[model samples]
Target: MSTGNTIPISDLITSRPYTSRSFLRECPERDPVQFPALWYYPVQAKAFTICSLCYNTIIHGFESGCGISFGSFTGTKHQTLFCMFGRPHPKYLYKKGDFLALRTFMASRTGLKVTTCHGLGGANANLSTTWYKPRNGEINGMVSCEACYEDYIAHTSFSSRFEKSAPQPAGQVWACDIAVPLIRRTLEACSEGARNDWRVFVAATTHRLKVPACEPYKERAAQSTRWFQPKDSLPGFIICEACYLDRIASTCIQGHFTSTPLSSGQIQHQKSLTCMLSYFPMAIAVQEVIFSENFQLWCEAAKIFMHEELCDGTARKGKSYTLIVKDGTGDADFNICQSCYTCCIDLFGFGSHFKQFDMKTHTEAGIAYSDWACDFYPTRYGFSKYMDALNEAVCVREFSVLGDFIARYQGVTQPCPRSTFVKGRRWYGTSDFSACPDCFEETIQGTALESMIVVRNQFKETECSCDIYSPSMRGIWKNACDTYDYAGFVELVRHRASVYWQTVPVMKRLLSQQRIRLMQQQTLNGSSMLYQRLDMSASASSSINYSGYSQPRYTYGAADVGYGYASTYGIEAARLGQQANNLVQSSRSDTTQVPYLEALWEAVE
Candidate 1:
């Protein structure tokens, strides 16, 4: 309490009339100790000699020699900017813009009365002057209140007073480190591009780093982060958790970018979040390989060079092969990979920062990673090797993706001729793409192996004129075949694993009228004396192209195998040709007699 005589409180307290609060506590064994000093709540008009708005605490700051000062509270003082004991803490926390408008930090504390009052528990209203320190010497612009002071003393142990105060937080630097390094050498899996930019400095209330100790003093320290932590060697970034969450939602997930310069305020905010891709490294791998610019180039390239058919999805049916209905085709076309089929290409969007996918879902589906990228592997991944990375970017990107496989590791450049002719089969041999002649009939064209009966006959060479290899026949076949190979699955399921059916005999008169030109006697002129019938029969084993699906059980001479390449070529040619030529059609094959190709699927009996 202040004295009318103006005696220094330090000297007056030495007279034994006043007692320290610590020594004044109640003890049942002793009577109340007599002392005159009352609780001095500092939250009053008398507590401040300087106004926060108009005041400058430094008395001799940055002047000449002895550039020192004292706070308004000390009668005899020394160097240092001073106000009360330390930076005063205001009672209420302020938000970003609120700090600048604040005029006064001083507010009311506990009310005082003339009469000395005691509580039932013997607790008295008495506070030590040292109860409120400078928040461990860190600058606090907040005004102290009775509750805050009590809170301060509650946690501050008496032993802590002798210990040195914690160091003050230095003010913040206005700029963040501007250097941005490439996430990787290649953006293969990275679906988006990023601008090299300065780190964002959010508002002071949630400043990850310490800022200026002013009217709006900083608040929380060591707040939780909302981003992937930078590599240990990299400089740390300080963004508001709000800014980070919003930035990710727009940049990564939605594949968007902002032209607006960043302010401390953010357009996006969330209650809570974290980096979405922090866990999946392979997608990170894919993203790193695919640069945004390069990905854009590839998308453009695909728009140009991809077959005209694929542009119209509904019009293009994937791979064409024979179905069970009597020589009908599956009518297939190119197809997308399993990944693309399941998710939209827009997920990466022209190239966004966050182009990630769930590998676990793919694994749960039991799909091989190869199958997942089967389409992309052959075409898109290798684009960079072929074209200029920038100018011919489209083609380069496209080549990098779709055609690079040809140049990469010197793999096959063109598909096999039979696969082109028979469109519905997926030929997975030891190579990326493969086809053998025999496999053409059973798998490619979806014909059954066990159903065909081979016939052997002796025909005079002079009469067995190889006439069916005509240009007209090939021309008609060409019209029906799909030239552009569509990305797709060709029913390449394990045929050997399928149950087989032994031959069942069905008699039909051998007709020689449909004989097509033989292999044109290319190797040996007219070496084959045997002429085989082309009609579907069960018992005989005379077909030239046996199930390429498997090898023949018994060895057979050339004479026994009489049919030639023209047999398959001419009939389809003739069938399509007759339709094109408007020629009268023959009776359709009896499909009811045909055995199921397999119990699960259409396989040969």
Candidate 2:
């Protein structure tokens, strides 16, 4: 068989002791192939310094026809970076890859595909990827070449065309090493409860290994058989260990945000029923309860999560919960009057948003400012910064909830098949607009019936005199409605006596959405109840209090003392700009001023 000459891929992976600290501290590439993964194998202990050549290698590897060979180097200032050079030029026509999809692939893999396309070009390249192993010594930096590299080029080329213009995927090795390990560790800890070890095993093999197990090997490992398969019964890429374990959260297990099992009584057919609770106006506000002082102590008694939950009890209380707040722009004053709805959508998939308002109003005499508009008065919410904060908050909440919930619930200990809750409905703003299987069949069945009616009425009537609406657009909308069984529409007309021209259901659905907003606010009470709660600086929100205005004495004023008055009076400009900013500065000055004044008096004594 010439087995000795042919080195198996498995043999390429050698067992090397991996310690979080050691791996982080030193580049073990020279020691041996301790880590598993093609990108990280062929161990070499060198500081990762990727050059132009390495970049070209990555690009060429990803660009199917681009003839480029990549040489990766370690033991330098830059860790695990490769110099990509020379377009290898393909002999055959490489498929014109989907640039958009390739960009998506690069993004998903935490790699950059920087080509000559984007104006910035190679200047954007980072010397080190966060994925680079970080430690405390000369070897503190190590490249995750194979781990990040792999067949990334091949995958990126097919992913999307967007990768062509953006930065070529770099630092992916570092990203994979850092992100995957962190995520896997988190998942493994969560999956510890699963007796079969299926959750952790699947995560390690598929996500960590980034490959499928061969069929022959799967058949022999009987004792660990369950570990090889997905518990959810859906066949696709295996989830990472952390994500798999996080699924054990109580929300998933309790079916609060997911689907329920279909009973046999409902369907005579062999297929299972699918249901899901689709949320509306997808983007929701995440309100973190903030306290003025040490108010978290009352949380348990109040039966609410408070600011302390965000930090330790020793610190102040702070934490946020995802919720759908009503858009109050239509109201008379344009205020988001605290109306809210519970955010009941799944954690991943599509995401949500939190909307801010401009609460400024002008009076006849002058522009009178309200407390609501204070945050944005100077420079309306820094939109980008606000969005960034919102994203961080959401990520933290999603992961934290998953972690906490899994610990409390046992059903999610392993993958389990579950049914959809409400089929055919898509939330308006949140992601997950694509129609699922349940809606597909229903719409197909309804199409013929609808077509027949439209044909029958084609010649019977003239168009409406109003002429404001388009029958075609309405028809398209109707088809969309039919195709997607919107729970919003269903709830709008649930109590109709007849099917002809039903209106009550629609009104009810609208009212129901509003009610949700109110409930979101009323659920939690006590010191934590406030709208604008965040960790911004104290001075940014407070008013400055100074005993007197700074008045420089003028010699000329003495000449006119009898005829004129020396006076200077106005609130500090900063005090007017940001109330809290004044307070913080004022407090500091006051603290130091008192000591100075005391020292002066002592010298006189």
Candidate 3:
């Protein structure tokens, strides 16, 4: 469908009742733009022209006191100039004809020409150096950042509260000492190119770190114990009756524990969630090695171990693998180790955090850690080297996930040759937007495993290529878009549609068959009911009352025999019954046969 008249985009967008005054019949004047308090704080119009400079000056002085310098800072005058007036600069608020004058002034003042400063941070950059803590506390739940401050003014002053409260912080500065240090380390390790890809890597890391930590802040204090209170040793904390049992099988079902036991038997109550990680550091050793530090060496060795242990002769048979090291004699034997299990699970997942070992680490010729002596092994042969290797593996895993997403979108088809639609023609892997051969075939496109699943579902021993121009395919794509992190699935669908418009005919045909099958099933059900009614009528006629129908005139070969009419009707009734049976059989056949067609339609769609 066509709209009756061509409407301007701006008019269409501003057509809503709340959007513009002309759109609504009657209403008091309200703010044109809606500001999200979660995104920015609301301050009075006057505050921007007064408090902002004071706020900026204070922050500037504070930073200066800390031996830091800000290239630029926001002032109250700028806030009112931007928020109250929709102009680029203070001069622009007064100027009527000269928009370029503001740019000229900005260049003169800063001694530099600038366009934009988007995508400035990286995942593996020295985050500590850039971390800043704003002077003002969180307002309206949003961090007080320079961008947020500017945004607050750019939109209308949302709330009158800013009028009463002190001036909002000039801008947000990096906060959280732990987060700053970790981010810094990450940035330092990342390559320049990787760092430059700020929107993807850096943003994702920061986003993950921003996840709110659990609350009900724990106060650090020593637990007081009553001397000789009980005969049984309850230790530092009480254990739940259900989970208190010792030496239970791994498969045995259980509930939340009163404490995280040292083993299946020994009880050790945890104070907090952090304690869960900190209590057993070795348990996460593999994870730390892969994600926290460089763990290339350990990853390689781990992979080889997994392949040998998990797979049976065939290279492609293994889905995943795990490794459990038994430290016969170590500090872990006497204490607790949580990192131990995590390391094995991470390797099993084949997550980017762990890297596979090189030829040297895999071979006997090179230095490698043994499960027995590695815990306290000397330098060069020490376990720290292995730990470092694991950290690299973790980084690799993260990069791998990111790289895979990028590669898929970019369509890097060199490594994995596959056919994709291009202008209603088959375009092989040589196209500019070709996909990665391995990822495309093994993960995204189609695979033996998927074929096996399809065959099993259909109860067929053979595999077949799936039709891309099918409703089922569309449904699958929609589901992936909804469930997975691929934000560009819809774009890909649009691209595919543009490339393969001709496939629309095939999809329509499949959809038509699907609709027909539904109609036919309904028809068959109706026919079955009609046949049943015919049988009931025949039964009634066969058992007719002689008193009501003294003589049946329309009997076959009646020959003036009034009493024998019932016999003739019974014969005719038997004939009708046979016909009804035939119709019922036909209806059943139609219902059964339509299922096959429906299956085919699903495959095509």
Whole-model Cα lDDT per candidate?
Answer: 0.24, 0.25, 0.29
lDDT of 2 by residue, 46-150 (tens): 222223322333344564343322233233211122211111111111234444443333333323432111111212236332222212221222223223332
lDDT of 1 by residue, 89-124 (tens): 221212122322221333322222211112112222
RMSD of each: 36.9, 34.0, 32.4
Candidate 1 wrong stretches, greater than 4 Å? 1-176, 181-224, 227-274, 277-402, 405-605
Q: Local error of candidate 1 at 349, Å? A: 9.9
Model 3, residue 164: distance off in Å is 94
TM-score of each: 0.16, 0.18, 0.18
Scanning candidate 2 in windows of ten residues, the lowest lDDT window is: 273-282
For candidate 2, the TM-score is 0.18
- Please provide, for model 3 over 1-605, each residue's C-alpha lDDT reduced to its tens digit, 9 standing for 90 to 100: 11133222222122211211111121111111111110111121122221122223223244333332324223310011222222123223223334244233333323222111112221222222222222243222222222222222222222222222233334433332222223323332332322444234344335435533321112221122101111222233232211122111111211212333243222135332221111222224323333323333233322233223221112221122122112322112110011232243333343322222222232355655322211211121213323333332332323343222222222221221222322221121211122222323323343222212221111112222222334444455446644663435435544654444344444556556656655665565556556556545554555646777534334443333223333444444444445555555565655555556555443333
lDDT of model 1 at position 106: 30
